[model samples]
Target: MSTAQATTTHDEIVATVTGIVAQELGVPAESLAPDADLRSVEGADSVKVLRMIAKVEREYDVELEDEQVFAVNSIDGVATVVLDTLAQDAA
Candidate 1:
């Protein structure tokens, strides 16, 4: 991992992702728990979810696999993929 990525904790990723999700999905960040399903949120659709993911990708400078991105349904899941991607990049 890069020096920064190596030091980034799971909770920090979750918090940053939660903020991006809230802003993109028009929901309060407080309402989005780490395990909260993005598809279950009010007004959330596939397009919105994809948009949120895109924003998150930009924030972290990582391009997630479509399979990985779609396989996940929560902020925690997204964070995991990002963490994995970062790990791979560093490797």
Candidate 2:
């Protein structure tokens, strides 16, 4: 019965995801755009993408579906999934 999870906003999720993606890809967070595909970035690979997803899940305390995770190609998509997952839990 904790409302702690409700405080997160979509912008915050996108910002957090951008940071995680940047960290995993060994790139500067400022270099990433919200709609840019992380996989298309230099130095990115499947392993790194998975690591980013794992870190994102850990950060939000949610387990994302593999289908959704695999379909996500940008920070915006990841943030959408996280927000959806959190909203589902809230329901």
Candidate 3:
């Protein structure tokens, strides 16, 4: 990844994850809040969440653990896990 991609900010990651979740759930990105519980959203399911995770992984070029995927219940949580994974890669 280029420096720009590698240095993506936490807010940017949350925005991207929110977009991915919104796309997967067929909802508007602006409709989803960073702190909203993804699983509790209308039309949300395990399959949709998994698809969102897959898209997020592809977007960030990181392999997230299944436990982390399931444990993450909001855009902010997903962003934190992704940022941590990226930081680990950098290390």
Clash count for each candidate, listed in order shown: 0, 0, 0
Best by lDDT: 2
TM-score of each: 0.92, 0.94, 0.94
Ten contiguous residues with the weakest lDDT in model 1: 1-10
How would you encode candidate 3's per-residue C-alpha lDDT over 1-91 as one tens digit per residue? 6696688999999989988888788899999999999999889998888888899999989999988888879999999999999989888
Better of 1 and 3 by TM-score: 3
Ten contiguous residues with the weakest lDDT in model 3: 1-10
For model 2, what is the alpha-carbon lDDT of residue 15? Answer: 92
lDDT of 1 by residue, 3-59 (tens): 776778788899999998888878899999999889999889999999999898887
CA deviation > 4 Å runs, candidate 2: none
Question: Which runs in model 1 stand beyond 4 Å of their true positions?
Answer: none
lDDT of model 1, residue 38: 90
TM-score computed on alpha carbons, candidate 1: 0.92
Tens digit of per-residue lDDT, candidate 2, span 28-91:
9999999998889999999889989999988889999999999989999999999999999888
